[model samples]
Target: MKSATQDKRVFTEQETSHYIGMSRSFLRQSRMEGLRKNRTQAPPFIKIGRAVRYLKEDLDQWLDSHRKMHQLPHEGGAHV
Candidate 1:
């Protein structure tokens, strides 16, 4: 059995990068882009001094918001 405290999903920058299969720099880039695009309304995050942490739920929601669906191939052919 998992304790409620242990079950809480809080991750550091490195953990988040690993979880998302992206480099730490890429995560920073994404964070910058999010800031540039005023994505505060998109997801919630915590900024502690020089370190930035993210909740799994917020990251999941952010990914869902940025997800691209129904993108057709450049060949311009429909998949039947």
Candidate 2:
């Protein structure tokens, strides 16, 4: 079996923000707060020196976990 990191698609902070449809600052704040609170509810990321990156597979899983499948359209569920 291959490790999760192996063959993963890495994205820069800017790219991740765009891919996730969130602001870069929001991503940074989420990471900072998650680290400060030692919480695991946020999406996973990697920090190398002064740079940060997110894995495409990880982001997909995170988004899936947060997805709302039963909510009405007006209940703030994503419109598809």
Candidate 3:
């Protein structure tokens, strides 16, 4: 059987920030806010000593939930 560490994936703060196109400070702020929404103490995350790592799947879901779709000027045929 594979070890737990082998099964688990980890990403550095910089890597995650670059992937999400956000500043490292912003990511730290979000985490500091306690991810306040879930009933059972927000989403699960991995922490390596003092450094924190986030799962790609969790980040993707968060992005999808916060995504916004705007209609184009002519695509939706809006009268102006």
Which candidate comes out best when scored by TM-score? 2
**RMSD vs true structure, all candidates:** 5.0, 7.4, 7.8
lDDT of 2 by residue, 48-70 (tens): 89888898999999888878778
Report the lDDT of model 1 for residue 49: 90
Q: Each model's number of backbone clashes?
A: 0, 0, 0
* Candidate-wise lDDT, in order: 0.69, 0.77, 0.64
| Ranked candidates, highest lDDT first | 2, 1, 3
Question: Candidate 1, after superposition: displacement of residue 21 in Å?
Answer: 2.2
Model 3, 1-80: lDDT tens digits are 86443344565677677666778877776666775665222233578888788786776676676566975457656677
Which is the winner by TM-score between candidate 1 and candidate 2?
Answer: 2
C-alpha lDDT (0 to 100) for residue 69 of candidate 1? 91
Candidate 3 ranges with C-alpha deviation above 4 Å: 1-9, 35-44, 70-80
Error of 1 at 48 (Å): 2.7
After TM-score superposition, the amount by which residue 26's alpha carbon in candidate 1 deviates from its true location, in angstroms, is 1.7
Give the C-alpha lDDT of model 2.
0.77
TM-score of each: 0.59, 0.68, 0.58
C-alpha lDDT of candidate 1 relative to the true structure:
0.69
The pairs that clash in candidate 2 are none
